[model samples]
Target: MINRKILARVAGVGAAATVAMGLFSTGAANADTFVPLPGGEIVKTLSDGTVVTVRLVGESANINPSLGSTPVHRNAWVSGSAQVELSGTGADSGGRIFPGYTVGCQVNIAGGGTSGGVDGGVAWEDGSPSIGASGGGDLSLGPGQAQSFYILDLEQADDFGSETHKKRNVFSGSNGSVTWADSTIGLSGCGGYAQARAFVSVEVETESVVTWITLYGQPFSIG
Candidate 1:
């Protein structure tokens, strides 16, 4: 004796509302998607049958927008550490067969109505036990557009030498961290999506033998 038509209409409305809520929740979760980057590793053998392995691990980034700026600027603080290990006969040779190694990091920015890039790295001399860092970048603004690039910070250890050599040559073990911060700004008529990337490199050297390897992380977005 009930109104069958009215009951069916109410049920359909309830089902539609449930589906709408589910779609909204999915969109919200996707907005917060931040994927963790994968690390890369490489291994090389010296002339004397010495095996050297380099790895880039614990890589991450933090992106932020500048405050109170007419043309908004985006900055990223990228952090990670490089590890070097020697095995086989030359593993324990220290400065005898293995001189030392160099570790470095660089950030590349492209798109978002801007163009430019920056990079930096450090060298460790086992014989001198010395450490040095070098960095540089380039940037130019487009018509009716304003952009800027900067290498904000770099941090590394300075313990690659001993009393005698003051800067010991390369050794077999871990060499702390090589971190850097870079930024890019876009203003006025500049309004588009920009992309950024982080990369690491390692170099191994001896008196007569030398080799180099590099790895890059997945690219991220900055708007």
Candidate 2:
């Protein structure tokens, strides 16, 4: 979560039950598995001599796989950090960072998933992908489907001075980062296997150009 208050937010009703089962169960059937992922790195130099680097670090997931009592449910706690750096003449300018994950149900999300975009397809208002899913990770999907959700729900005042929630963070001065731990991912309604992949999309703005760069993390099994 971008906001400290939002960290470790509940994935769904199943999270509590899953945690309890992991505590009391002794057999491998209910044991939790911890996976350490090799976070990735990407660098791109904008034609204007602006160098941008994005890295996904400290990535991991603790999966309960199943509730054991239900074949349609899976639970996991995920953690990671998204870091960005900018250099060259435009480094001083600011940009927005949006970090989230795409969870698929028997759908191959590699290289950006199916035609329109992952499950439910990518939402683009003006030819740019906008990850604006506000609903939490408690998802329902069928085979060959997928969905995306952001890890941040920042609370702040809008132009009218009323409370509003923002999914991205604004940063400046050549560097910015967002980290989250124990973020819950609860799934339901897919009788088959499921998988999830992390994504960090950053909007970089220099004097002459505004570009979006997205980096995808390795996908992992939910069961």
RMSD of each: 21.3, 9.7
Angstrom error of the Cα, residue 156, model 1: value is: 12
Q: Highest lDDT among the candidates is held by which one?
A: 2
For every model shown, what is its TM-score relative to the native structure?
Answer: 0.44, 0.81
Best by TM-score: 2
Clashes of 2: 0
Q: Which stretches of candidate 1 lie over 4 Å from their true place?
A: 1-35, 66-72, 93-191
Number of backbone collisions per candidate? 19, 0
Global lDDT of model 1: 0.31
lDDT of 1 by residue, 86-169 (tens): 565445433211111121112222111112122222221221112232222222223232222222222335576433322112
Q: Which ten residues in a row have the lowest lDDT in candidate 2?
A: 13-22
lDDT to native, each model:
0.31, 0.66
